[model samples]
Target: MAHTAGGTALTPAMKIAIAVIGVLVVAGIVVIAMLNTAGRDGAEAPPSSAPTTAVAPPTTPGPLPGATPTTGSEVPPPTAAPGTGLPPLAAAEPLVAAPLPKSGSRDGGLVAGFPTSVAEPMEDSDVVSTSIATENTAMQVSLVSSTTTALDEIRAHYRALWTSLGLREQPGDDSTMAFTGEFESLTLNVRTTGTGNMYTIFGVLRTE
Candidate 1:
């Protein structure tokens, strides 16, 4: 039998051919849709024109929390404690006295620059040794003599001499006594030399 959609008759081979052409058209339409979907997935979208927020850096540095601020412009100077400070020097102006003399005494006689204020051992005393030491700022005189004068007279003579010069007598036994004055100190030592009375005098005079 022959079938026709319009006026022409359709053969078996012609019908099969028409079915194949219809299948081919459907396949082409499916391929086109799949290609469009793949293109959309692969391509990047255009950037947005909307504004965005951003963080900014600080303008000035500051100390951390819990930090303490220092006080005042400077520290006060240290003060010397009472009695613990250096001993008073010669009891005079400027307070600090010069160093002691270092010269030695060898032969006998009176040393040069012996202070007239410090009286000699005695007119009859036999001199054992004498020395004179001088410095730019000070002078030291020392005398050693052996005398037959009475112990009381010898002591009294020096005691009166030291008192006249306004020196304060320091504590001492019968053997030694030191008289302290302004700018100087005088130490007189007396002892029995077995044969006679021996006396030694040390005078330190500070000049200017």
Candidate 2:
């Protein structure tokens, strides 16, 4: 030991040893910090072959078996009543109207019982070529081609016409209309065919 001014002094060898220990401690702390940083980076990184969730496609419903699908705004034809002897409702035939006789006889045209004021004859090339009428009662089958009128309009026209004439509308199907008054009754059958541009009107009238 060497005595200095009022204190003991360390030797060169001791000082050198203390300095080396301090350097070793700092180096150890730096290596631990670097290892900790590398571990955190590895934990945060995403793997290249990670599993992913798959999305499914949407499904659509289909019609059932033996079912026919309807198109557009047209309603399906109604079921036939029992024992009517009439075939299942089918598309109407496209009939062209012929020139009428000069005698004003709608013989091959609409039935006679239809009100002349509310009913008008169609064009020469748009009406059925023949008509069926019975005596003592105006029962007729006539087909009139309609290129501009809609089915609802035609239905409404007849409804308003009969109601104004003091007739009550009878319940019927989509292809048929019925009206009954105190002394008269009428039935109208309507259908569209041939590109849906032509309409056929069948009429039956009875008087008391």
> Best-fitting candidate, measured by lDDT?
1
What does the lDDT come to for candidate 2? 0.59
Clashes of each: 0, 3
Model 1 over residues 112-204: C-alpha lDDT tens digits?
A: 545555656588988888886877777778888899997778888999987876778999897888888677778988888788898988877
Clashing pairs in 1: none
* Per-residue accuracy of model 2 over 1-208 as CA lDDT, tens digit each: 6588978788999899999999999999999999999999999998789688897655754555777776743567898877978788553321212231121224445543343433444443255433545554334444455445667877777788767766678899998888765445566566676655455554544432
Worst 10 residues of 2 by lDDT: 94-103
* Candidate 1 TM-score over all chains jointly: 0.48
lDDT of 2 at 110: 54
Q: Model 2 off-target regions past 4 Å?
A: 1-115, 118-125, 130-132, 137-143, 206-208
